[model samples]
Target: MINIVYRLKSPKFFEESIDEVELDGVIVRPTHLSICQADQRYYQGSRPANILDEKLPMALIHEAIGEVVFDSEGNFKSGDMVVMIPNTPFGEDVYSPNYSYSSKFRGSGFDGFTSDLVNLPEDRVVKIPDDFNLNVSAFIELISVAYQGISKFTQMAITPKDNLGVWGDGNLGFITALLLKELFPKSKVLVFGKHQENLNLFSFADEIYRIHDVDDDVVVDHAFECVGSSASQSAIDQIIDIINPQGTINLFGVSEYPVPINTRMVLEKGLTIQGNSRSDRVDFVGVVETLKQNPQLFEHLEKLITNICEINSLGDLKDAFDKDYISKFGKTILKWNI
Candidate 1:
């Protein structure tokens, strides 16, 4: 089938390309898409010039939900609402394909969900309730990332989860803190951030504190650092100082450069640091099941949708990215009218 793919030909520049999509699997029409920090890095040319040169002219946006347009073998009916999984794995293995070198992730090096229609493997799409919030569902892939991290932490941590601290007040931090509350109801969920306005949105958390305002007496049994970039170092440092011994530190931040770790403190405190990246299919399934069981999660997730731009052309798409960059908090959702 003929498809229209909108790719970032250059920084702040997009061009359309004509491609033939094979009918080997399911074809989905993207309805709602969300902009991510990684997409912004490419749009703003913040990545190293060499890396940009290698990956540019690629279609962006991996977090999205769509309507099923076609499904081979009739496994799914037409017009079914489904969340498209971006991680295309080769086969099952002991380690997750999301962390494997063989996997091809959309919007990073491979083409994302920006085309007129996406022909994806049947296993890559999970059906969602038709009535679910489409805007919130657009970012389900992101929520799965947090789910993956928390799942790993719960499975490996031998210490108490009495107090859970989440650093950074952005979208990821909000989602992590909220999920922690839902998963560990008895635990005190504390959120630490610099932006008062952003931190205010995490109303579900048991406690909120400005990073600098945190009392010396306060501490958490575990910490999650969601602040990426150079600032992640600061959040990690603060976490190291306040986290209890044998605590698990979950790192979700994506930094271009390496963040320094106080190994002396890490050894003295016996902290376990785990790095979290993109999630696999199981994480997506778990998140979907969780959402179905706790329908109220949509209400909390709705607060993260700050900008909803309708995309009919490349100009509108550019406008949405520009708007997302300036906004201090929340997600910029693209209403895919194209």
Candidate 2:
């Protein structure tokens, strides 16, 4: 079969190549691919030059859902919809998924799932419910990251807190806060964001506060920082200021530069700071089960998808990435019918 792949040969340029694909393994056609900040950084040439020089000329998408076309092993039947897990671990490790030193994450260290058909090992693909929306499944990889972070948080948290806080109203913040609320329904979830319009979309949050408007009296037992990039430090500062003593701060964001944290305050408060990245199979299974059990949660997650651009050609792929780059809030999904 002819497989056409969209590769980033240079900044702002995607070249396509036609090649034959081996259908011996599980062959899945990517139906929906979501653009992540890391993908954008590669496309826009914002990443460090040395890293870009090494990783460019590669496919640029990791978050995606696909339909099975062929599975030689018969583990998954044709026409089954599945979410792709991008992290491919080479060796076993007792540590978490992202922490595994031998892991190869797609769209970063390896080519990702943005292609005509993805041939993955049976273990890297998890089948989703037939009734589930493919658009929402496109983001399951991201949602699983939050699931993994929260899972770690639950394991490490010393006590149950009635209140939680999420910083940054971006997609990660939105999903993290929503998942927290769903998992802990009775807890009061407070969201802090700079943009009121973006904060408005977070209706699930018990209270939304503009970063500057957050009162001094507001206290949270735990906090999550979702604002990555240059704003990560500021968000961490705010998280430290309001989080109660001995609170756990989950760092879910990615920053290109070293973010200086207040070590003095962290030590004084006896806080626990944990950082999370890509997720594993356990997280993927948990997220899929949660979506199947709670239809309403799936609907709420669908609201986070702001743009769905269809990719029919190389031009369409460029447009999808470009549109996602300009989008202020929500996720941009590439409908890969090509």
Candidate 3:
């Protein structure tokens, strides 16, 4: 089959290429693709120059939902809606799937789901309910990231906490806060952001506070740092100050530069900080099952999608990326039906 792929030849420029693909496994046509901050970093040349030089001329979308066109394995019927798991492990290992050193992830070192048709192994895709919206389903991978972080926190957290703090108003923070509420309904989930306007969108959070306005009396048993980039350091500082002693902090953000932490405070408080990156199939399965059991979570998640642009041509693809570049909040999704 002739596959049309959008590749980033340089910063803010894309070239379309036509290549032949073997239809051996499951063939999926992308219905919706969501641009992640990491994708933006690559497109804008914000990543390390060496890394960019090595990984450019690559397709740039990992978070997506697709419709099954054909399945050689016959595990899924034609026209089935599925979520593509971006992390493709080379082989089984003693460590966790995502932790495997030989893992090949789409949109990073390998081609992603930005092509007109993606050929994936049956194990790499999960079927969703027919009634689920594909646009919202595109966020499953991102939601699963947050789910994985929380899962890791549960394993490490020695004490149960009633209050949880999430920092950042971006899509990651929004999703993390919502998931925290859904999974632990009794816990008070507080969201701290720089912008009140953007923070207002987090209606699901138990309490929303401006980072500057948070009182000294307010404390959290645990915290999640969803603020990435240069702002991550500040978020971590605030978490260190407000989080209870012996608290476990989950770092879910990505920063290009090395972030400095208050080791003195960490030692004095006996704090534990854990870092999380891409998730595995089990995380995806957990998210799907949670959404299936609590469909209302989907409705709440829809609020995070602030913009959706249809990509019918190369021009449309550039426009979507440009719009996301300037977007101050929420997730920008590319409707890839074209």
For candidate 1, the C-alpha RMSD (Å) to the true structure equals: 0.9
Candidate 3 residue 116 Cα shift, in angstroms, is 1.4
Question: 1-338, model 1: which lDDT tens digit per residue?
Answer: 99999999899999999999888799899999999999999999998999899998899999999999889869989999999999998766677888987788999868998889999998899999987899999999999999999999999899999999999999999999989999999999999999999988898999999998999899999999999999999999999999999999999999889999999999999999999999988999999999999999999999999999999999999999999999988999999988
Which 10-residue window in model 2 sums to the lowest lDDT? 16-25
Name the lDDT of candidate 3: 0.90
Worst 10 residues of 3 by lDDT: 91-100
Q: List the residue pairs that clash in candidate 2.
A: none
Each prediction's Cα lDDT score? 0.94, 0.90, 0.90
TM-score-best of 1 and 2: 1
What's each prediction's TM-score?
A: 0.98, 0.97, 0.97
lDDT by residue (tens digit), candidate 3, 29-71 = 9999899988998888988888988998999899999999999
- TM-score, candidate 3, is 0.97
* Residue 237 displacement (Å), model 2: 1.2
**lDDT (C-alpha) at residue 310 in model 1:** 98
Best-matching candidate per TM-score: 1
What candidate 2 gets wrong by more than 4 Å, as runs, is none
The residue-level lDDT of candidate 1 at 41 comes to 93
Q: How close is candidate 2 to the true structure, as a TM-score?
A: 0.97
